[model samples]
Target: MLFSLITMAIVGKLLHNKGYEIEKLIPFVLIAGLVAYFIPIGAIIIWPFKVLFGIIGGILGFVGGIFGSTIGGIGGITGGVVGGIGGLIGGVLSVVFGIIGVILGIIGIAIGLAFGLVGLVLGLVFLFFIPATILFVVIKVLHSETKIAPDRR
Candidate 1:
């Protein structure tokens, strides 16, 4: 799990530096790692390496997002099942509501993805603007040279 998280973070940073927006991939990688950890199938052989590949693959352009989204869909299914089971208590209505909650959670996740994309764009814009503003102020101050000077020559 720790390795998976670290790998995802590194890949995410690398992809971001390479002009790729792969923020959506993180959750997918996380889910895959969790499944690998829990499931005793042949995942033992492929899981670690797949995790590595996923991390690296997701560091690029739309590719990472695509892979991540795919994995995330799988994860969503598992999550829905787990969430529904966990919430299945307190009567029949609770189970029904739990199913509804699971569906809502999936919808919420989709909404979050949209918001994440928007936030990424806004954050990039802010990154450029904030630095430019700071630089402009610094340049103006330097040009004016209005600060008090030292007494020494």
Candidate 2:
């Protein structure tokens, strides 16, 4: 989490230095980070599982097709239809989950940007404020020290 925040800040700072608006580029940076780091890693981790599932599903499907064929006529058609429907449902669900992931990613980026900006503003305020305040106090003390008292006589 800290690493990601630091990375985002660095990327934004670099872009800001290049005269680009960080706000507009943050999402692209985030997406690039995700694609560069996460996606390939995720795919590498998931590949074996995907292959295993595919083989298992194929074997089960073969057995199911044999069972359906033994039952003849409508049973075979029904199994095929059911498998098609299941595939359709799975496709829809993958799309829905993909969309949800995108939406959540966008929301997360927005929140991070908002917090980063707020921190930046507060930091700038305090960064100047503390020094300015010390200068004001020092000036007042010096002015008081230099001022001569009026003669009582």
Candidate 3:
């Protein structure tokens, strides 16, 4: 299960980077991961590796963004990369928070852990990684606005 979740996360992310934008599938992946975590189907220790990879990906993206910005006349190049990193962060955060939320939620049910539930939901949203979708849309709008549209007349 752990292996599958990790693979799905990586593959989905790659697809997203390649313009597929498969944000809708994140929640399913995350819920699967959470269930797998409890069922002991995967190495719980592997969780840290997720965070590590996310950090590495983010750093690589930041460097890429730097180069892109320098080469491009405007921030157009970097913004997408930065936004992609942001989306990656969101995915990573979802995994991290989901793990925490599940653990605490199960343990805190008796105590009514609203915080845990809230965190879990927020994590779900992040895991879906919707920000990149929105960011790209915004970037497109801005890019179009900056362009001198040919007059219809």
TM-score of each: 0.26, 0.41, 0.24
Candidate achieving higher lDDT, 2 or 3: 2
**Candidate order, TM-score descending:** 2, 1, 3
User: How much lDDT does each candidate structure score?
Assistant: 0.77, 0.82, 0.76
Note the clash tally of each candidate: 0, 0, 0
> Which regions of candidate 2 deviate over 4 angstroms?
1-69, 72-77, 144-153
Q: What is the alpha-carbon lDDT of model 1 when measured against the actual structure? A: 0.77
- Runs in model 3 lying further than 4 Å from the true structure: 1-74, 110-153
lDDT at residue 134 of model 1 (Cα atoms)? 92
Model 3 CA lDDT for position 1: 54
Which candidate tops lDDT? 2
Candidate 3 shows a clash count of: 0
Best model per TM-score: 2
Give model 2's TM-score versus the native structure: 0.41
Tell me which residue pairs clash in candidate 1. Answer: none
Superior candidate under TM-score, 2 versus 3? 2
